[model samples]
Target: MSQFWSELVHNLDPYVPGEQPKVNNLIKLNTNENPYPPADSVLEAIRNATDDKLKLYPDPNADLLKQRIADYFSVQRNQVFVGNGSDEVLAHAFQALLKKDKPLLFPDITYSFYPVYCGLYGIDFQTIPLDEDFAINVNDYGDQGGAIIFPNPNAPTGRLLTLKEIEKLLINNQDKVVVVDEAYIDFGGQSAISLVNQYHNLLVIQTLSKSRSLAGLRVGYAIGHADLIDGLERVKNSFNSYPMDRLAIYGAVASFDNEEAFQQSCRAIINTRETLTDKLQSLGFKVIPSTANFVFASHPDFSAEQIAQKLREKAIIVRYFNKPRINEFLRITIGNNDENAALCTALSEIITS
Candidate 1:
């Protein structure tokens, strides 16, 4: 290690995002990105924003974007906070709301970024194991943390918890913060944003990168009580007031305004997800019940890594983790109709051969 590096840097383990391969015309499905393009109105809004406005910094407050989000979620602008992406918002959250005397709590198998944030901010955290079925049983949490956070439709497994279950944790853990990272919530699950007004301790974070098909733009936000929002604001202002660029603010606002297109795309992904699940099951793969835009499955006879390698040889990519309970499973993103068909065909050959 370099002597110039800080102690934190020397010990930090960064989160590994899935590869964005440069190969052309590949059936890319490793990362959970929307296979559909953004609405035409979103493009128009970004194009319209390419005027003399580029000469100056965007409103550091991101007033119009915040207002759009607040109106859409039925919250006040003061109760909302926007950042370059949900990852940035989550980092600020770890530093502000989660760093308490008690250790933060999350699923042992989750977004994979939660623990990284804890390490980055020096936040104490403990991992509660998912139940035998790879599902989070909210009752097990039992009010033992400074804060709680997890993806609703959790990553890798794509399992979701009901609003009733979420409310149970929030009610029991009212003394501390509860952050719900809803980056994939728009696909088929209900949002915890509906309960933000009821729970002052709850902060629901969302991103346009997945559901709105705008990963390149990097826009994400959180809805919470004004006090919690203030904590994020303190951290954000301490670092950089202009976390969101002019284009991101404009484009994300347009994404919120184009509700019909966003919903339609989500519907498309959900439909394809169901179809893909059935196709996998028919081939003897035990696919988990998924409410997100991805499916996690594995065949009883074949290994996850073996299938992943076979798929890769055919120019298809899917996620295979060599971690604990999930090592046998493959996490496949639901792509467009053609892409799904290609994946199905590839799996058929791989399984039959």
Candidate 2:
């Protein structure tokens, strides 16, 4: 390590995202990204925005996108805060709301970025372990943390925590902020935006990357009480004045108008997820019940790392974690019909050979 680095930089353990290989024609299902293209209208919106507007700075507040998101979620404009992506929005959140007197709490196996954010912000934190089935046990939180945050239908495991459980947690910890990361909530899970008004402490974050098929656009937003939104806005404005660009703002706004494409893509991914789960189970895999657009499975005979390596050799990639309790499982994103079939065929060949 370089001596020029600051103390915080030296101690940092950054989050490692999934690999983005340039290998062509490979079946890539490692990252949980939508395989479908966004609505043609969204593309057209971006094209229309490509004029001389690039020379000028975008709306610092991203008011138009916020208005559309607010209308979609039935929340007021004052309750919405837009960011570069959910990652940035989450970063601002950890600094604004989560760093309180007590330590923050989150599911141990949930999103990996939570801990990285805590470290970056110098916030004290604690992890509550998921149950044996990899499901979040809300009772374990027990009003201990200064704030709470977790993916609704959790990542890597593809398990969901019911809204009732979320409400219970909110009721128990009424004084603290509760952030629900709903990046994959549109697949088979309902969004917590509906309950945001009921719990003033609740903040629901969503992205256009997954459901709206705009991963490249890098736009995400949060819906919550106006007071909570104000706190996040304060942090955001302090860091960057123009988080959302002109193209992203227009494209994300148009994405909200494409209801048919959004619904169709969500349904297709959900269907493929179920089919992939059944196919894996037929091949002696233990597939967890998934509400998200991915399946988490493990085989009794083969280890997760072995399976992952074998798939990579065959140009098929799926996510595998080396951490405790989940090291044996592979988190496979649901691809298109042809890609899914190819993965299944490859697995069958690997299992037999």
RMSD of each: 0.8, 0.8
**Where does candidate 1 stray beyond 4 Å?**
none
The C-alpha TM-scores of every prediction are 0.99, 0.99
Q: Report every candidate's CA lDDT.
A: 0.93, 0.92
- Write one digit per residue (lDDT tens) for candidate 2, span 241-273: 999999999999999998999999999999888
Cα deviation of 86 in candidate 2 (Å)?
0.4
What C-alpha lDDT does candidate 1 achieve relative to the native structure?
Answer: 0.93
lDDT of 1 at 115: 88
Residue-wise C-alpha lDDT for candidate 1, range 1-353, written one tens digit per residue: 89999999998999999999987988999999999999999999999999998999989999999999999999999999999899999999999999999899999999888889888988889999999888998877765777888988888789999999999989988898989999889988999999999999999999999999999999999999999999999999999989889899999999999989998999999999999998999999999899898999989999999999999999999998989889999999999999999999999999999
